[model samples]
Target: MSAEIPAWLALESGLVMQGRAVGAEGEKGGDLVFNTAMSGYHEILTDPSYAGQVVLMTYPQIGNYGVVDEDAESARAWPEAFVMREMSSIHSNHRATSSLPAWLKEQGIVAIDGIDTRELTKHVRERGSLRCVVSTTDGDTTSLVAKAKATPSTDGRDLASVVTTGAPYTWAEGYHESYPHELGRAFDGAGTKGGGERIRVVAYDFGIKRNILRSLVHCGFDVTVVPAGTPADDALAHDPQAIFLSNGPGDPAAVSSGIAAVSDLIGKRPIFGICLGHQILSIVLGAKTSKMPFGHHGANHPVRDLQTGKIEITSQNHSFAVETDSLPDHLELTHLNLNDHTVEGMRHKTEKVMSVQYHPEAAPGPLDAGHLFSRFREFVAG
Candidate 1:
């Protein structure tokens, strides 16, 4: 079932890298970005945060451990395109249900291997993330380069619609299983409840991850996930005890309607946001958002909690960040990215709202920041 697939990745800067296609031989276009994590290719591929981007893994060899059902962050694979130096043809892992190549074919994601990813990453780091096209069927580098150059960047694109579900869906119970790790045992009481009533939580899916909902449900919250464009009034009609904004792709400024909805719900109910959700909250609070040159797209990012003065390694995937200088008086900065000193987390002084720019659920990253979920749970309980 293998075919000799020729492909070329053309960047907006007119730089073209020739390679061979591995998964779902086709053409795909997106903003090209790189990740530095040595592992967790499956989690990264399924992460909705990478919706409109062709993810390039800086760590050379990928797909060694293969794909596992339990490790999937989202319900479906989402990377528009995947780039790596080399993809392991033979997967080796006890929990692996299928190889990465097989999983990509099933999901219809275009992937490229046998390219120097480090050089490409270095190029992106110096020139910033750019729109690019990965073509497997087409070998005309000139036309591909032209198309890549003409493609619009992620600046004002409303890519959330592309990745979000069209209708509200309910996750059946028992979807999440517990695991014991260094962070301690999770889901101690899976089916049994001690005493307190189940907290009803309404999550607005602007490209949500399965892990986030699982984490909330594991914390005793009865979760109901809604679509991205669901109106604030409509969400409140559900009588949810808390509101959650899921991580998503594209610009926060482009999601003006969602920002407005969040503004209306501010101070009305406890709310928590991640990644793009965090940016939207800041925009609702009169702060501004700007696109990063290269952006952060890795699992080993370091973020310092200003309140506790403790640094936690986190998983991050975003191209836009909330401008700390433009934050309103009521909002307080809670976390800072130690690498770039960017605003990572914020809380409203007078409102029951808090958000973080990094993924605390950590599908492919560290669990050091899992306490943020506990903080959100406490906020909802109060």
Candidate 2:
């Protein structure tokens, strides 16, 4: 083992912290945000929704179980940099193919460890997420702070397009587990619960996660994924039974093309969206959205269903949310976050359109909200 290299983290607030370099040797900067999930660091790292940001795991000890190929949420890591209190060198897991730091280095993601993540997270909580820089190449605090201050924000950028798939593709794979036999569509038979013809769905890939596609297939939808820039007419050409808008990164208002596409497809098909998709859908429904103070980015958020009076713990990752006062009369509120009273879910009063601000796929979160996929299936059946 070579001697550990020193790294520095500088926030736009002029605060600087020193740590040990764990991943690639270089410099990177972005909006510094934190995730509270204790596990699923792999999923968080590969999640395209983390694009244009630096992720700080609130969990004190990360990488104990190591990295596995099957756990990746996307093809490549999306966070500009990774920050954690401790990056465990010894990893032991039956499915792991490589250690976390090794995998980060392989993916060319710059990372730092041994920093006081609790202090950093508290800073973000009190001051909101800030632009920051992480570097192993630069040891000067003044230089790193200057770079952090100069880092571009994701406020108005179309980051989804930066991570979206370039071409259309078909997905048939399902969840790897068989214990939950009712909700999984394996390669063999028609694994749908009802044993009927699968409903066709056109899913807009605005930085989609693989687990979402698997969840859709598991719920008996034949999914055809298209680029974020795909037009409504082109999507309608697929002759889908429903349309899905996926979770993504950055300001939803900046995704003007996606908003227009969803606007045209509103009444043509039953539509469902999550995260960035939820914001865009709300925007099309005459609702306004604004960036949250610190934003919600965790797996343990509690949401109450207005109709059922049930609270569901959900996985969420977003910086902007739909404004409650801006909700139009044509839409009805379906879910609200118990923590901060933010809009968690909603649906059209007449049209077959619905959306949620959290991840029901539960890649790195709980399975309490997985029924939303089935609910979408019900919308298609109706």
CA lDDT of every candidate: 0.83, 0.91
Q: TM-score for every candidate vs. truth?
A: 0.94, 0.97
lDDT string, candidate 2, 132-184, tens digits: 99999998989999999999989999998999999999999877762244334
Please count the clashing residue pairs in each candidate, in the order shown.
Answer: 0, 0
Model 1 error, position 209 (Å)? 0.3
Which predicted model would earn the best lDDT?
2
Query: Which residue pairs overlap in candidate 1's backbone?
Result: none
lDDT tens digits by residue: candidate 1, 249-336:
9998998668878878887889999988898899988899999989998889899999999999999889998887998899999999
Give candidate 2 misplaced runs (Cα > 4 Å): 178-191
How well does candidate 1 match the true structure in TM-score terms?
Answer: 0.94
User: How far in Å is the alpha carbon of 98 misplaced in model 1?
Assistant: 1.4
- Backbone clashes counted, model 2: 0
